[model samples]
Target chain A: MELTRRDALAALAAVGATVGGGVLAGRYDPPRADAASDAGSGSAAEPTLSTDLLDLLDAAAEVVYPSGVDGRRTFVETYVLGRTENQPAYREGLQEAAAQLDAVARDWRGQPYADLDADVRDKLLRDLGVETAEPVADGTITERIRFYVVNDLLFAFYSSPTGGRLVGIENPIGHPGGIESYQRASMSPSSAERSGGTNER
Target chain B: MSADGGSGGSDGGVGDGIDRTPSPSADVCVVGSGPAGALVAHRLADEGANVVVLEAGPRFEFSERTAQQEQHIRPGMEDPWEMGGPRDAYSTEGRHYPLNAARVKGVGGSTLHWQGMVMRLHERDFEMQTRYGVGTDWPIDYDDLRPYYADAERAFGVAGAMDNPYAPPREEPFPLPAFPPSYSDSLFAEACERLEIDMHSVPNARNSEPYDDRAPCLGYGTCKPVCPSGAKYTAESHVAKAEAAGARVIDRVPVQRLEHDDAGETIEAAVYATPDGTEHRQTAGQFVLACGGVENARLLLLSASEQHPDGLANSSGAVGRFFMDHLFAGAGGRLDEPTRQNHVGFNTSETHQFYDDTEPVEGLKLEFLNYAGPSPVIEALGADTWGDELAEQLNESYGTHVAVGGLVEQLPDAENRITLDPDRRDDHGNPVPHVEWSLGERTERAIRRANEIQHAILGELGASIEWTVGPESTGPAYHQMGTTRMGSDPGQSVVDADCRTHDLSNLWVVGSSVFPTGGAMNPTLTIAALSLRTAEALSASLSDP
Candidate 1:
C-alpha cells in the first residue's frame, strides 16, 4: 500500500491523539516527561503564556494540524494549555513568539493584536514565519519559537502509542530478517527521494 | 604466621591451610564476567571444577529495559562514542596510547550491546609477527586453535557458515545455518559481487534458528540497548550455564587487587569490595583475570605490594602494552537499483577481498561488512548534510541503499600501551585504567590505501558516495584488543603460552588482552576460543599434584 506524506501526517495526528489520551489515562509511564520536568525544574522559575497568547497559539497549532477527530484539541491542549503550566522553556518560547506576532500584526495592519480580525491574524502569522520585521540575528525570537513548537509537536506525537504504531516503531521486540530485505531494496534513489531522505533509515 | 591465618593442612603455611571451615572458595576464580570470563567459567564448571566468577556490574535484562529506560542508563546509549575516561586517554604524540577499550561493568559485559557480527581471523593472522615485522606471533597457531573455534561456535549458536568460503576451515558446520540476508545486506552483496569483492554471509553469534532454548532473533531494531530475545549471545548466557554447572557467580563484587606472598611468585588471594562497599577476600587454587584488556592490566598494575614493587606480574615489564583495535571508516551511497531491503537479519553478509597477502605491505587485511538502519540521529545527520534532498532520497531508498565498509587490521606497537591513571578512579574508588595509544605509520598507510581500494570497489558496484570517514583517520572505533599479549618469551610479554603470568604462577589472563594482533575480524569468537583453551588447561593443571 502506497502512503502519501499527507496520509502519514494524518496517521501521525490520529496516533498522537490516541497516545496523548492513553498517556493521560495511565496506560504507560511518561518517562521522558518525568525526565524533562526534572531537568527543567532546577530552581529556575517557569514562565507562562497569557490567556490571550495561549488562545492565539491554539489557533496557530489548529491551522497546522487540521485533521483527525481530536487533532485540534490535542495540539491546543498539549502545547497551549498543558505545556504552559509545566514546561518553562515551552512557555518562554511561546510568549516570545506571541510578542513577535503582535509586533508584526501592529506593523502590517496598523492595529493592536487584540483589535486584529481573524483573516488579518492568519495573514500576519504566515508573513511573520516567512519574513523578520526586526533586524534579527540568526536565531530570532520567531525562529526559536517555531523550532520549539515543531519539536514539541513531534515529541508529543512520537511518544504516543498510536503514533508509534503507525510509524512502525515497535517496542523492545526482535525481528531478525524482516526489515533487512526492505532496507536493501529501499536503498534505491526512489525511496530516498520519496522520504526526502529526511527520516533516518 | 599471621593474625588472619587459618588451621594448617597440607602445606602448614598461613593462607595455604585447608581448614574445611566451610569458607567460601572456588577451585578457579575468573575475574570479569565478560565474554572471556564467561566462557572460561562455563568451560571450567563443565569440566567439574568449582569456578567462582566476579563481575563489577549489575545483571542486565533486556526485557526489563524500555527504550526510554536505556536512554536513562547513560547518554549516547545507542551510539558508541568515547566520552573521556581511562580508556579514552592518548599520549601527546597523537599516536593512540592504548585508548580503544570499551568495557561494560555488567553480567554480560559489553556483549550485552554488541553489533552481533562474528567472524574468525584468517589463517595468516596467526603468523603476522613472522610474515610482517609487526606484532607478535600467537603461541598457538590457527590450526591448533581451529577445534576450539568450532566448539565456541556451537556454544554460542552462530548463524552463517555455508556460503562463506573465505571463512576459516571448519571441522564441523555451524550449529545453525546462515541467517537470511537483510535487504541492506543483499543490496550490498550485489554491489560487492559487481565489484568482484566476493560478498558472502557474515557469521554472527546471534541465532538465526532456535538453538539451546534461546529464541531466534526477533526484529526489535534495538540491538544497541539490549536484545529483547536471548538470540544475541551475551556472557550472561555462559554465566548461567556455568552457574547451572555449579559455578558460583558473585555479582556487584569488584576485585580491587591481587595479594601475593613475600616471594611474590604465587598469588595468595584476590581482595575485592562488595556492592555495599564492604571489603572481602576470596582464596582460590588458581586465578584468571579476564577483566578485559584495560581493567585486567589496570588491576595487575594497581596491585603494587612490597614484594613486587612494579606490580604483581610486571617483572618482565610487559603487563599492559601493544593495545590495538581495527580502524573502521567508510562511505555509503545510493545504488542505481533499489536493493536496500528491510530484511531483519542484522549482519547477514560480509566481504574479505582486502584480506590476505595480496597487499605489498606485509601486515594488513581488510574485511568489508554491511551496516543499515540508520538511527534517528544518523538519519538527522544525513538530512542536515543533504538538506531538502534527504527526505525524498531516504523515502525511496529507506532500506535499499548498500553500506559496505572494511574492518582493517591494526599492527601492534609497544608504544600503544594501556596503563593505570595515577589519579582517576571509578565509582568504587578503584583507580580507572589509563590508555595511551596511537596508530603507527604502517597502520596509517594501510588504512589510506585500503580506503582507496574500498572506494574503487564501491564505485565499480554502481553505488554513489554519501559520506566516508577513514581507515587512517582518528575516530572512536569500538573494537578493542591487545595490551596484555600472550607469548613464549616472558621477557617481552605478560602471559606465557597458556595465558599465565610469568611472575605469578597462579595468575592467568583471558580475553583480547592476550591477543598479540588485532585482526580484521571481530575478537569475541577468538576470545571465546582462547578462554575455552585456558579453562581446559587450568582444569587439567588443577587435577595434577
Candidate 2:
C-alpha cells in the first residue's frame, strides 16, 4: 500500500510520542510550582491549563502547522499540557499568550479564537503582525503570541519525529538514527550533480 | 606529617606512617579516573597488580544517557552532568578561562563529553627548542613515545587511515579503518582542492566497526556532550575493565591532599573525603597524580609541607607554573545549497598541512566541522514567521550553513598559571584553584593566520561569511597542558623524563600536565601514550623487591 503523508505523520508521531514519553518517564523532573500561598503548605499540586486556554492553543496549532499534517490538535494538546508541568514562569507565559490570543479574537471577530473559522483565525494572527514581530515576554500582544504561541507550537512539532520527517530531516538533532543514513551525501540537486561528476563514487 | 597540616582538613583517619596501614592497601593508588589515571590503573590491574582508583565525582550511568541527551538538546535545561557547584568552584583571572566548562569530574572524566579527535604530535613538537629556538625541548622525543603511541591506538581502538601526509611517522596501521569524510566535509573538500590544501581522515577514538567489544557509531549525533551509544571511547570503559581485573574503583571521593613522609621523599597516603564529610587515607607503595592539568597542579600545591614548603615536589618551584592551552579560530557562513550539517556530530576529516609551517608561528591544524548549522527544532523556534512561511524558512536554513575551524598552539608562559585562591574555599575547606591566563602575542598571530586560511577556503566555496573568530574573540579549545612541566633539570620543572616528580622518589605525575610544550593536536592521545608508559614503569618498579 502506498503511504500517504497523513499516514506517515500519524505513524511517526506515535513512534515519537512513545520514545519521548518512555525515555523521559521517571527522570523528567521539571521545576516545582512556586505558589506563594502554597510555599510553606507543602502542596504537590502541579500547575495546569484551563479548558478554554487549551482549546485556544489547540486551534492555534492547526493554523500554525503545515496544511498536509494531521493530528495537530492532539499533538498541540499534549505539548501544551506538558508545558504546564514546566517552570511556573513558563506555564504562566503559555496561559497569558493564549489569553491574549482569545482577547484579540473577541475584539476583532466578536467571538473566542477557538470558535472562529480556521481561515479567519489565520488572518487574525497575520493582521496582528505576529509573523514579523520579534518575540518578547511582557511585550506587545504580537510579540507574546510570536514567542509563547507560534514558536512554542513550532518547537513542539519540529522537534518531534513526525514534523522532522515532514521537512525531509529523517532524524533531527538529538534524535537517534543509524550511521547508514549519514554515511553518504543527501540527494539534493547540487550534491547529486557533484557526486556524479567529480567526487569519488 | 599529619593529614591536617597545611592540607586544610580536620576530619581524618589512617594517617600514621606508611608501614602501619595494612587494611585497605594497594600496590598502587591512582587519583582521578580520567584518561590518564584510568589507563594507568587498568594496565596495572591487567598485569596482576592491586590498584585503587579514586574519582572526585559520581559515575554517570549509561542507562541515563538518553535522558541526558534530551536535557542537552532542549533549550533552558540545566547541565545534564551537573558539573558545577560549591564543590567544583574555581575562579579565573585574566582571559576568563571557563574551567568547569572545559572539564568534568567522574569515572570517565572529561572524555564523557569529548569529541574523540585523537592526533599524534609531530616530531618537531618534541624538539620545539632545537627547531625554532622558542620553547624548551621535551626531555623525551617522539621516538620515545612512538611505540607507546601505537600501543595507545590499539588500547583505545582508534579508527584511522594512513592518509595524513603531515602526520607523525608510524610503524603500524590504525586498529580500525577510518570513518569516511562526512557529507558536509565533501563540500569543504572540493574547496580545499582548489586552494591546494590537503585534507585527510582524522583519527578518532570512536568505534568504526565495533572494535574492543563496543558498538559502532549509530549516528546519534550527540558525540560531543553525550554519546548514547558506546561507540565513543570514554575512559570509563577502561575503568570497568580495571574493576573486572581486581582493581577497586571508588567514586564520589575527592582527594583533599597527599601526605608525605618526614623527608618528603615519597607520598605515603592520599587523604580523600567521602559524602558524609569524613576524610580517609589510602596508602600504597606508589602514587600517581593523574587529575588532569589543572587539578594535578592544585593538588600538589595543596599538599605543601614543612620539608617541601612551596609544595610537595616543589624544590624546583615549578609545580603550577608554565601553564598552556590551545585556542581556536574559525569562520563560517551560509552556502548556496544544502551542506547537510548536524547530520553527524564528530568530525571525520581535517588538514594538518600548516601544522609545521613556521611562517604562522608553528603549529596550526584545521578541521572541517560537521555539526555547524542549526538543527530543525532550533530553526523552527528561531524563525520569525508562522505557518507555511515558517516551514519554508526551516527548509532553507536547516542545512545551508557550513564552517571551518582550526586549533592554534599557545606557548607556555610562566605568568599564565594556576594558583591557590586565598578567599574561596571548597567543601573540604581547601583553597580553590585560581587560574591566571592570557593569550600571548604569538598565539594571537597564529589565530589570525588561521582565520585568513579559513576565509580563503570559505571564499572559494562561494559562501557568504556570517561570523569570524579573531584573536580577541577566540577562546580556549579546552586541551589543558603544561601546568606541571617535565624537564631533566631539578630547578626548572616539576616532573622528570619518566614523569616522576623531581623532589619525590615514589611520586609520579602523568597526563598533559607534564608536557614541556603542547602542539596544536588534540592532547588526549599523548596523555594516553604517557599513561601507558607510566603504567609499565609502575608495574616494573612494583615487581622489584
Candidate 3:
C-alpha cells in the first residue's frame, strides 16, 4: 500500500506525543551556518532558501516523503521558504546540504539530483545511507544531508495540518482547532467510538 | 507644591528640567493600568470621579494582537509587545526569578498573557495564623470581600459551575456557565474517580458565551502567551471601559515616585516621566499605587523623603518585606494509548479537595494539564531516524502522554523579599527592584505532597513515569504576593484593612501586593475583588469630603 501524507503526519503527531510537543522545536538558536561553500556571503540579500536549493528540496522530498503524495513541489517549496526566511544561519546550512546532495548525485548519475528519475534519486539517497548516519553540521556529507535536508523537510511536513491529519491530530500543537474540536473525543478512526463527553468532571 | 498641569489642584507645581505637558489635576490618580488599577479607575469614573491612570508601557493596539499571536507561534520571531528592556530591568539576590518573563509593562499589564483562571479564596485563607498557626491572618476576612468577589465575577464574566463543594460560600452563581472539560480531562477523570479524589470545573475569566460584548473562546490553545481571539478577559477591556466612562488613561508614562506634602501625612502628587524624557507631576486629592508586588514596593521605596526616609509609606518598616509566591509541582508520563495532549492550552478541570485550612501543609490545588506533550514538528525533527523509520517512530509515540500540575501555597517570609538594587539602574536612572527568594521547608513539604498525588494518578493509568518535578526542581508559579501586606496594626504592615496606607492618609496600595497571606489559588481574581472594594472606599471618601 502507498503510504499517504496523512500516515506521515500521524507518525509526526505520535512523535510529538512521545516527546511532549513543541518543547524541542526551535528551542535553540539555529546552528551557525556550516563551514561549507554557502558559509560566507557578504551580499545584502535577505537570508532565505534560494531558488536552486528549493528545486533540490523538491527532488529530495520525492524520495524522503511517503510515496504517492501529490503537490510535492509546491508543499516543499512553500514550507522550506517559510522555514528559512530571515534565518541566515539556517539557510546557509540548507544551501550547504543541497550542494553536498548535488555533488553526490552528479558523481553517481552524471546529472543534478533534481534531473534524475524518482527511483534513481531514491537509490542515490539509499546508496549514501544518510538515513542511518548520525546528523551533524560539520561532520560527514551523509550526516550534514540528514541534519539539514531530510530532517528539515520531515519537520515541515509533519507539523503541517495535512501532516497531522495523516495520523489522528486534526489540529497539531501550536495550531488552533476551534474549542469544539478539543471538547470532542479523539477523531482517530480507531477511537471514534470512545465518547469523550460522557466522563465530564 | 504640586504639579497640577491644569487638571485641577489647589497647589501649582512645575516640571523638573525638561518641558512637560501640563494637564489639569484629577480627583484620583492611579499609578498603574493593570486589572487592579483598571477596575478601580472604571468604578471611580463611573461614579463621577475624575481619574487619571498612568501606565508604564505603550498602548498595544488590539487589532495587532493576532499578529502578536503569530509571533508566539512562529519560531525565532521577535516578541511583538517588547515588554522588557532597559526601562524595565530587575535583578535577583537569591533564587533566579525571570521577572520579565513573569510580567508585562503595558497598559493592559500582565493580564494580556495570563491564563484566565479565577477562583475565590476560602475563608481559611484569611485567618491562617488562627487556624493553621503558621502564616499571619488577613486584616479583613472572606466575608468582607465576598460581595466584591461576586462583583468581580460579574465584571469579568466568569465561566464556572457551583460544583466545587470545597469552595467558600457564595450567594450568587457564576456569571457564565462553565467551560466543558477538555477530552484530556476525561482521561484523568477515570483515575481520579478510582482514587476517590474530587475534580470540578475550573472558574475562568474567559467568556463562555457572548457576555460583556466579548466573543466566546474559539479554542486557540495559546492562552498563556497569546489569545488571538479576545475570548480570554484582559484588563485592556476594563481600561477601554474606563476610557468610555471619561477616565483619562495615560500610557507610556512611568511614575517615578510619590511626592508628599512637607508634613508627609498625605501624598501630594505622583511624579511621572513620559517617553519623551519629560517629567510631569500628577496631583490629585487621592492616589492609588496599583503596580504589581515588585513594582509597588519599588515605587514606595523610591519616594524617600525627610519625613519618611525609609520609603513613602515605610514608617512600619514593612514596605518591601514578606514577599510570597506559590511553588509549582508536576508529574508527567506516557500511556499505552493516545492521550491527545496539547490540543487545548488551558485546563478545564482541577481539584481543591487537598486544600486544607487546618493541616500543617498549606495545601495545594491540582490541574489536569491539557497541553503537556511535545509538539509533532519538534519531535519529528529531534528523532534519530528519517523517512519510513521516523514515520513509524512518530506513529508509535503520538498521543500517549499525560501530565498533572499543581500549585503549593507559600508562607510569607520577610527574608524572601523585594528590595532595591542600588547598583543596577534602569533607563530612567532609577534603582531596580531586587528579589531575594528561597523555598521554605513548609513550601517544600506541600510540593512533596502535591508530587505524591500527581505520581499516584500517573501510576494508576499503568503509565511509565517520564519525569517528576519535586521540591528540588520546583519553581514559582509567578503569582507574586504579600510585600505590602494588609493588617489592622500600623507597625506590622504598610496598608490597613481598607488598603489605605498607614503613614499617608490619602495614599492607597492595591493588587496582590497587599495580600496579607498568599493562597495556593490564582491571585488575579482576589486582586480584582480587593480593587473593587478599595474603589468603593475611595469613591465614598471623595464624595464625603
RMSD to the true structure for each prediction, in A, is 9.4, 7.2, 8.4
> Which is superior by lDDT, 1 or 3?
3
Give model 1 RMSD, 1 decimal. 9.4
CA deviation > 4 Å runs, candidate 3: A1-68, A72-160, A188-201, B1-22, B378-393
For candidate 1, write residues A21-109 as lDDT tens digits.
Answer: 42243221212223535667422233222225545554544333312324444434443344344335545655655555555555578
lDDT of 1 by residue, B1-545 (tens): 22232234322222323221212667888888888999888888888988888776566654553332223222223322223443233332344433333456778777876767777788878887687766678888898888889888888888876776666687777888887665555545665666677767778888777888888876545555456556778888888999899888766567888888678788878876653345556788899998877778888888998888778778777777777777775556666654433224365666665577546343333434334434321232223212123333334444335555666677877776767765766655666666676766666666777677767766876777776657445453566677788888888788887888878878999988888887877789998888888887887788892
Worst 10 residues of 1 chain B by lDDT: B380-389
For residues A1-201, write the lDDT of model 2, one tens digit per residue: 112333323323322333345223433222222332345642324222223566777788778887766566555555555444434587678676776777677768877788899899899998999877766766777888887888767756765555665565655665555565554666333223445677654
Query: What DockQ do the predictions score, one after another?
Result: 0.16, 0.31, 0.23
**Model 3, DockQ value?**
0.23
Report the C-alpha lDDT of model 2 over B152-259, residue by residue, as the tens digit.
999899999999999888999999999988778888888899999999999999999988879998777788888877899999899998989998887777999999
- The numbered model that scores best in TM-score is 2
TM-score of the second chain in candidate 1? 0.86
Q: Flag regions of model 1 displaced more than 4 Å.
A: A1-201, B1-23, B68-101, B189-191, B336-345, B358-373, B376-401, B426-431, B471-476
What TM-score, to 2 decimals, does candidate 2 have? 0.82
Regions of model 2 farther than 4 Å from truth:
A1-64, A71-156, A160-162, A165-168, A187-201, B1-23, B381-389
Query: How do the predictions measure up, each by TM-score?
Result: 0.73, 0.82, 0.81
